[model samples]
Target: MTDNFYMLTWNWLADSPLLAAATEVTTKSDGEEGTFVLAGVLLSLVIIYFASKLGGELCARINLPPVLGELVGGVLVGVSAFRLLVFPESGSLAEDSLIINLLQSTAGMPTEVASSVFASQSEVISLLSELGVIILLFEIGLESDLKELIRVGPIAAVVAVVGVVAPFVAGTLGLIYIFGTPVVPAIFAGAALTATSIGITAKVLAELGELGSEEGQIIIGAAVLDDILGIVVLAVVASLVKTGEIQISNIIYLVISAAVFLIGSILLGRLVSPLLVGLVNEMKTRGQVLLTGLVFAFVLSYIATAIHLEGILGAFAAGLILAETEKRKELEEQVVPLADFFVPIFFVCVGAQTDLSVLNPAVPSNREGLIIATFLIVVAILGKVITGFTVFGNPNLNKLAIGVGMIPRGEVGLVFAGVGSASGALSEATEAAIIVMVISTTFVAPPLLRLVFKETETATEAVDKVQE
Candidate 1:
């Protein structure tokens, strides 16, 4: 009787003035809402570019990786700091975003519809951030020397395999046993340790004039292979995270599918390379080569996503394939502008979404996360350092240099953190811990690399003097 009365009363009031006025107040025209969304996005981009460039410039000036600066910049502007670039996934409300606030306060954006606009703006920025990573992987694929990688195969393969397995095992088991972290999150954090920042390492080597040295070649080759293996591991772990349960059959299926996707993409891509070149050559129009290259990359990225794999993997494979073509050099040069424009967005966004409050040791609950970060840092350093000794038959080789070169996690580590966070596979503590580990390893490795190489050089000088 009570329910019937309420239903009748509600139905009677549906067309009443009170309900009509309430709906009118809450609702806005689609055009007005879209305009607000665009305004919010534009303002956000302005912030992103400023932060990325500012951070990158400062880091570049100080001899650290410019990428590190970008991450820091993001933190300063993100949830932990100014609340400038907050996201919904990182436990932030739409009102928490200063951009949304600015839109309403300045642009006559209706307060009732502000939440919708914030969501729309955030979704667009997130998409752009993802695209930035895809381009980054593509650029990495182009920079890799497939032919040289093959030539240096045996020793490089050993180093890469050891580099991956050691940290992965150590970090995963340590997290599970010591911290009592769940299996999937533990695996994800462990995988973050397995990345070697080829860009950072290569830059350091070039500065030290070791780019062509035997150890350098070995490091280069191993890092390239490390990237491929890391991608596969990411695919597998990310798949496990999505399913929320790990079955042996599922693992086998993901592994097989990843392998088939990468290998088939490469083989088919190589065959299609000639046709790509032919099409580009036939076009007398401007921008054909660059446009065609991007098309191939996007298409592969789509295919990868459709198959429940990472689109970045497809983009990387696309770069690797196009890298084998006659236009490889030209395509590489052309892609740099795009990379410069988009890649920082990904790095910055990773930093922005990270909540560093969990790193505070003062909070009793936060203590475990701090300990986890420290453990990961130790494992990350030691794991790759062990890979240095994996090389054999080269008594003169500076094994320490090889190991140190693989230590910096750099951009690749951030990729793992981003994916883990996005998938809701990591807790705030674990995510922050992973981010801390990445930053520590990245900053620590370059100076350590320099020190190890210096020792090797000094010892060589002493030996030469004695022989003389």
Candidate 2:
């Protein structure tokens, strides 16, 4: 039966009209050219979506955020773990490959074949991943109100400042003293530790339906501020790494540029939003609201990238402006489905980036990196937790929850470490340790947050009874 089927397949292929054309194409390219396969792309997406949903369902069963599950699912299918989506070893995907190798060693196909396949698709996959994040942030922005952000602005700023300063100082000193890292790489590590993955925190809060609460407001507000501060820190540190000297004027210029860009964008967005709403409302087309919202987001995202800020920031700002418009509810309803489809991809990609082999005690270097990572993780947790107690407003607020919310290092930390490694600022051991710290914080924070908020709810209920 098998032999007959094989003969039939070859005979069918030989008789096909495109057979001569196919042969000519193969002759021309000699198998060197890679073509994008639609079926493969679709299969990858289906696998990722299902794996993410399964991971999310598992986390939900344990009373954790679905975001946590999506992340774990990514790890399961990512190049580091199951090697589901392997990329090239060098050339275009060299950086992405390095990241995967740091987390887990590659296996399966020959390097040449794997590289060819990844090279053809990696750029598109990366762009899609970025779009996922953009939509995620835009949804977050829609859920948030400008008034709420402003209301918590002062406390958030205070929280952000303390969060940034505490982690930087402690992380730097700990790396230098405990890990025996040099000053520059230590600075890079410290800077990496200071990053708070606000996207993860926002998703967790939103999952709990606490996104509109005072504590949530404070956390989101602080996270936005934290992101700005992180950009500044990353810029300064990256500059120092590149130049081997800190130019005070250059630092000042970068800071001012970031501040101005954020402020200017928000101001401009607010001014133009009224006209945008009017224009969209005038359109008789179906889904005009959603289309306009996306266009607005994409334009701002483009402007942000042009100015060296993360595109997600622009997306968030666009959401904020749109949130103030009359079509806010309609926009939210329309954007949810789109967000659902894309958001899990971002989390899965994040998870797939993890390298668990680093924790294997059987490997000596892994053991050493694990030790350093363990110490750094402890520091990373404590430093953020310390920020919670420093909040002066709202004595009744859940400070612990706020701190726990800020704990996850997520993508931002990985990006920082990746840059440092690329520039030769961080040693292999140090880079490995940083990735461990990032993964640990991200993994533990969700459950820890649930535990913290559970206590907060209990305390609040007790207080309510006493008042009654």
lDDT per residue as tens, model 1, 251-310: 576667766887799888888999989999999989998899999999999998887667
User: Which regions of candidate 2 fall more than 4 Å away from where they truly are?
Assistant: 1-35, 88-114
TM-score of every prediction relative to native: 0.79, 0.88
Error of 2 at 59 (Å): 1.3
Among all windows of 10 consecutive residues in model 2, the one with the lowest summed lDDT is 99-108
**Model 1 misplaced stretches (Cα beyond 4 Å):** 1-28, 175-245, 394-402, 408-435, 442-468
CA displacement after TM-score superposition, residue 249 of candidate 2 (Å):
3.5
lDDT for model 2: 0.82
